[model samples]
Target: MRKLSLLFSISFFSLYSFSQSGTMQYSGGKSADKAAVLIVPFEPFMYISEIDRQVGLENNLDGKAVKSEFAKALDLYLYQTFNEQFQVLSFYFMEDDVEQDLTYVYRSRKLEYEVLPEESTPKAEEKLKGIQTKLSKTFKKEEDESAYGGQIVTERDEKNKFMNAIISDQKVVDSLNNRYNASLYLLINQLEFRNVYGDFTQMEGNTYDRIAKVHYTLYSRRGTVVSKGLATTPFPASDNNLESITSTYFPILAEQIFNAVNMDITSTKN
Candidate 1:
């Protein structure tokens, strides 16, 4: 009898863990498949020291530039993944927004500027800016077709520029709902990336690694968070390089998140 009880306990926990792999607010069945989701540009957090020490990027400005490049790449990857699952509205400055850039993401009401270097050569500054521009243009060719089904609306009147729609605000939600009439607005507050050094038993060999932890909140038209999901994607030990590993696993991680959060709200309707 004791052995049977132990086996049952193990079986129960295995099922529970699989269900809980993707974070969910309230659970039961899946939500409407047609529900539109506004996916904002992913805000990124990367350890500066890791870039400088491990990646051999010494200049803080250069480190920040690399950080910016990764942010754009992550945004593109996320939009591409989510676009496949839901009708997505985006405020990604690199590919979508008309005027706003990183400055807008600083979000005026919550503005925090990076300190300018105390002393820097003009040549260095110019070089960094050049690299930034080049990297910005690199991802455009990757998209073979437009998922939005129309030419991207790029030309906007100046009066509507500098939209900080990337961050969650009642006004932003209301505006997007007014425009796209999207049912849910997903605000990704942070996509934290950290370097993992050395090998683990899962795969052998000393190598650098990374983990992408996405923290997101989903709001309804009433300005309430209907659901929240967090996805932490770790690189498989076999072949771990930041860019390559992320590209391979991000889709799977995103699918996991969608499965959990896309859960039918009907099950919890009161």
Candidate 2:
């Protein structure tokens, strides 16, 4: 009886280990304990307070540099954080054909990678037309606010649209899968830093409560969405020092995003 119990224990342990290893196909059928994830290049969008903007101007700071630094920092922290949960992360740049060894590729077609407000204005017009059809011709257009379309498309919306477009395009999806052999694809769509303390124009403190919003989408090899949302972290606002922002704020943002991804994965499994 004891011998039979020992045999059963061994069998259970082996099965557990096998199950713990990644179930998805990775790196040409090699067994991976963690899911292989492919990350798209980071796209950043900044809407800083007037005070911060002035600070940036005084310091000769530009959005491009800040965006690039944040991208690298987030990429590094993401790998470090996700490494605890999985391994095999890589990056893919849509405009660049050269492949890099970094923990995040080539692209066939050039993508604008942005959705301008003008592009979505036509859809609003169509909707208005439909409503007009339901009403009488006498419905005078009183300078429709929708025609102005002040709706700010948030990062979350942008990510959704971008992911949907990519998923529908079979060629892009297939090409990535062939090259990366990764089942999970993550795109860091946009990052935003907002001043949470009073009006943007009136804020005059050296440090104020600020929130960092990171929008992302995680999809499967078949384009099935695993997780999609914005991860936000609050920090004390400071100067636009690249090193300061990276070292102080990025890890916090990374941790928040990591928790979000991990939660989603667990929820999906359940």
Candidate 3:
């Protein structure tokens, strides 16, 4: 009886331990390689928009807020998606650090700018002249306005060109070769955000919605572009619920970025 009781207790404990291991299983895409990957902290860039900038400008939110939220979401997704196969390392690069080792940088020159509400009529034309002056100081005009709200516009201007060039300088490349021993670098240029608004009359009173579109590019360490990916996600502004929406969508955005990187790595390996 004693021997049997001991055996049963041991079996129970073993089962409990197995259940508590907290191991995650990945059954989604192809597995990642087991080799260690140094993921440089994703550098954040600007998207020209009033709403996008307001998150930091008026809300008193800083870059750390954005970084923290992104890191949390990305860490969770990566763990679920790749933990079983690859060992991931955080490569946090400060401005100084990146300046010392960056090999290739990504820069975007805006090719379009359009204000909603056509500037065709005399009154509209006058309003546009003022808007154009302000815009010209900031953004270059690519083409004349066609439609009022949903028209496409193109413009050319340098927003963060200087910083990007410095990151891709020869000095940075030499440092990367000497210090981190990194062979590959990724650059995301031109992550664009466009605002879309709509109104509808329905049984439930009125409905309004806003959406955002993102465009980006990926480049290799040696200045070879690996891939380009774009994502358009909806962001509804209802009673200041922007933060919650941002939290939800950022994970999706991170996943899209990860997918781009994974594809590039696979292509290079093949």
Candidate 4:
């Protein structure tokens, strides 16, 4: 009986570990002391999955509204967590002046990378749009021309879009740094909520585990880039709401992010 119990425990532990996976990638283990970091308002990946768009059409979903809510939740969490040492100051954006339009990317079991706009948009109107838009839309199938569209999303795209938005906001970052008495600025280039498979991947499977990825760049007060870091939850996918990802899985990732900050700041002597 004891042996059976021990075996069960080991099995469960292994499965738990296998389900949660993440990484922390950064450059320069240097430091930045007295760094009152400015956390610019978070941005979503300027992306809309075909599925999300259709669901929006059916359910009247507003991607920006959804993202705004997510941003608020995330900002509150970060403030509560990091305000002490870093003097974390957050900004909320109301208007965006970026000229580029948001694009949709189709992800599915077969494809493993981002499908370019020129590659996927036109077929959205074709019969077998989105998922059914064929491996290559050029080889149009006259029979399936009546099919509608669909879409899929991954964590990577969200991260990229968020990062790009901040990169474009360089004009304002310098001012914020000075006003906040910040020696460093922490901006999340990407903070996305997505479901991962129990297999720690999105390829296909029924296990709806949840995971999040955050890409941040720390800049000096003068706007000189210091370090870029990534922190992902070591949790599997779930049907849970986005807010819970931070409460449930972010402790570990948060620690890594702050650790990177300390490593950078503390390593640099006065």
The full ranking of all candidates by lDDT, starting with the best, is 2, 1, 4, 3
Q: Which ten residues in a row have the lowest lDDT in candidate 1?
A: 18-27
Q: Count the backbone clashes (under 3 Å) in each candidate.
A: 5, 2, 6, 18
> What's the TM-score of every candidate structure?
0.49, 0.57, 0.45, 0.50
lDDT of 4: 0.41
**CA lDDT of each prediction against the hidden true structure:** 0.42, 0.48, 0.37, 0.41
Q: Residue 119 of candidate 4: its Cα lDDT? A: 27
Checking candidate 2 for backbone clashes, the offending pairs are 90-104, 91-104
lDDT of 4 by residue, 1-270 (tens): 333234433433332221011111111222223345656533343222222232234333344443444455555556545644655444432222211111111110011122223322221123212211112122222232122211224323221222322233454555444334556667665564443323323335534334455556666776555655555553443233333444565555556567766776666543
> Residue-wise lDDT of candidate 3 within 1-270, one digit each (tens)?
333234433433332221111222222343334443334433343333324333444344443343333333443443334344444333332344453332233222222222222321223123223322212323332242221111223342322121121243455445444544334443333233333323234213323333343344444446454554443345444422334654566556556556756777798879
The number of residue pairs in model 1 that clash at the backbone is 5
Give candidate 4 misplaced runs (Cα > 4 Å): 1-35, 46-65, 93-174, 198-205
Compute the lDDT of residue 37 as modeled in candidate 2: 76
Best by TM-score: 2
> In model 4, which range of ten residues has the least summed lDDT?
100-109
Error of 4 at 189 (Å): 0.7
Question: Model 1 compared with the native: what TM-score?
Answer: 0.49
True-structure lDDT of candidate 3: 0.37
What is the C-alpha lDDT profile of model 2 across 1-270, one tens digit per residue? 333234433433332221122221223223347677765654232222222343345445443433444555566667556656665444522223323322221223222343324433323233323322121123222243232111123322212122211345566667667766677877776565544444334256554455565656677788677876555555555655545655676777677667767787889889
Candidate 2 lands at a TM-score of: 0.57
